[model samples]
Target: MQDSAAGAATMKALRRRRGLSLAGTARALTNVAAELRLPALPAVASVQRSVARWEAARPTRPDDRYQLLLGHLYARTPAGSIAIGPGSDFAELLTALHLLGEGERRTAELRTAVLRAATDQGAGMLSLLSPALQAQLAAALADPARTTDETVAGLAAAVADVNGQVGTLPMVRLQLLLAPAVDAARRLLAAPVPSAPLQESLREAAVAAYTVAARLAFETRDDEASRAAYTAATREAAQLGRPWRQAGVHMSHALTTMYATHDLAAARVLADRAVRAAQRGESILVRARAHALQAEMLARAGQARQVDTALRLAWYDMEANHAGDPAVTSFSAGHLRGFEGVCELHVGDPATAHDRFAHSAAALAAPRELVQRAIVTVDQALARIRMGAPQDAVELLHQSVDAAAATGGRVPALRLRDARQALRPWRQETWVMDLDDHLLDGLGA
Candidate 1:
């Protein structure tokens, strides 16, 4: 087929219709190559990359090995499956293949529209982008079939970059970014790499992708989606067979179950799993966070003594923690303080909760911490209400809901609702009424 957008679109459609990743496509080629003992066949990694390049229909990279191997994989699978379904889709690919026809134009238009919706979301979301991001997005809009040449290291960086933006982007928008990224990482993990180290790196990247995916899925209030992402992440981390990796995965699961789902029993179990794994691993950060999560789980259960013990252990872990394990979860002293505030509130000590929350200023004040800041802001407001000064919480509650508007705003929206529930006792106060009006009014920014 000639290098054209329609050609690329047809190829991608065939693959998607097959419900396979790029690596799954690579597997078909490699399996055929091995069956025939095809000598000098391109490496599995090369085939995966070529599939990517082919699907882009880049002019410079004309197709090679356009023989039985490609036949067994692409051209044949559909015809064989057709004995089993869509003449309409195949018609598009076939007409597009003739290379300058009506089918080509129509197919490409629909493809571009769907791709733009997946990537850009909408003009309102797009308008909020920085000029540089907008330019980058413009290029993507211009070429729906284009993709980056992703190396293992490049994929890792992409995963890291997406994870780093967790709280910054709205949950729905973040899911859009993460969906393609996670697909890429999972595809790479499925492909065969030349070296053990490269394989390990891909596994690491996949776990990290799923970790953030679980958080975003949970934040979007899709409990089943979050569970599926966590299951995949834990499976990948287990395949790595590293305690630190498991620690990271379980810690993420613990946080989700505890905060988002309120599954305290499961949270306790996951938190203990994280602590055990961290104990056997090298990240002091993970160690500290694990204990802190354990403390929160216990606090929520009203076990004050155990909570204090866990909190003390976590403080020591943080004080002594100088370990930086990128292979593990990212944490900060701010996270520990937030955990302490949670513990304090759950243990019926609003004064201490307020005091503890003061140290979480960094979580609430950072520009990049949109979702997290809203969560902590709500917590701070709750502390004020619990301390018999419901009036003091109104301003902070307003700030929390405003942050909700700025972010994709689901997770924090729930928090804002629960905060409202907590304010029912003082609903007659003028400040409470105004706060209610502000929240009811699209959480005015």
Candidate 2:
């Protein structure tokens, strides 16, 4: 293995046998890190370079973490392992070796058990008359130990970090982060824990993970997965008995219903539920978010009076709430303004919508909010189109499309498509045709 050519050939062969591209292998390593609760996961680029180094046999042996991941990836068991060592923790080594040995069967059984536990809330009695059968049952029912408060808090922070990165990262990369987090959260929920506080914290973390998953799914134009994730979040939030969590879940569901399904009535209902849930909580941030969602739904429904009332309520709540916990609710003046701008557009106030969008875009200066700013810019462009400024709309639309394409945001891509259709009256105009051509070139349409 120390021979450069032989090591390079072996590494390349292993990767090929797994049928994974360099990027795919990097993503798989990320997922393995998340699932195993590793302290650190390498960046995709780092993993890509490492693969290249291995294929080149540059006298580099990856650290323990990468070695374990590689072993797992290649299905190396205890008998066939190349990485397990005396310094490795015995329990972890055994677990990894066992999983590698029975990967498919164990994965299927664990998935089935998790689903059953989630659906039933209790497992059925198993026949354990024999010692061998008892051992098998014990192994099947084993769960990870309860995590510490600090660990739980760290997991929550990790989810928030991913949420903040959504605007900056490409959709595929975000999904890679989110999928494993969601899976780990669900697995934690299925495991038995001793403390109520631990359970509550886990539920909260799970709710956040599920909400982020739902948001990502919505952005990627996966309506069914979005709804399912929202439903799962709602369920987890309900288990925690936290009105703020419930309100957040409902608000997320309302957004999906409004944007993805175009079910305005259902959106309104969900928004109302969110508002009611928030009213039962002390978190003014949650209450304000609920009101803002209500405003958007009402605006879409053409209820101008109700929309204004909802916005006013949200404003009042925000004024009263001087502080907020992002882990619980991420409502801010800028976010409210963006929502208001969207509502204003729907309520036939293109000028106000444009102004609001401009303000919101200026306020949203965070690097992670780039995609969001681009989205608002696109909406502002739509307002311009409504105000009979097709040329300005075309320019803004081009900027928005470029920004969205950079991040692979499906929602903005869809909006750009709609904007193109809206320019049908001026389709034959030179600028309009040029915009269309640019769009086609960018989108490979």
Query: Which candidate comes out best when scored by TM-score?
Result: 2
Off by over 4 Å in 1: 1-150, 321-324, 327-329, 362-364, 443-445
**How displaced is residue 25 in candidate 2, in Å?**
28
C-alpha TM-scores of all predictions: 0.65, 0.66
Can you write out model 2's per-residue Cα lDDT over 95-192, one digit (the tens) per residue? 43232333433333332222222223221111101223323324423554635565455557557656766666666556665675577678778887
Clashing pairs in 2: none
Q: What is the lDDT of residue 118 in candidate 2?
A: 22
Give the 10-residue window scoring lowest on summed lDDT in candidate 1. Answer: 79-88
lDDT string, candidate 1, 1-445, tens digits: 3437766676677778888788887878778678656655577787788778757745223233432354334323343321100233433444444442334344433322222333442322222222334344344334423212234445555556556555555567767766766876676566555567767767887888899889888877898999999999999998885788898899878877877767889888998999999898877777888899889889889999999999898899778738456534466778788889989999858988987777786655544566777787788888988888878887888888777876656667777888888999988989888888888786542
- Rate residue 74 of model 1 by lDDT: 38
Candidate 2's C-alpha lDDT?
0.70
**Deviating ranges (above 4 Å) for candidate 2:** 1-143, 324-329
- Angstrom error at residue 7, model 2: 40
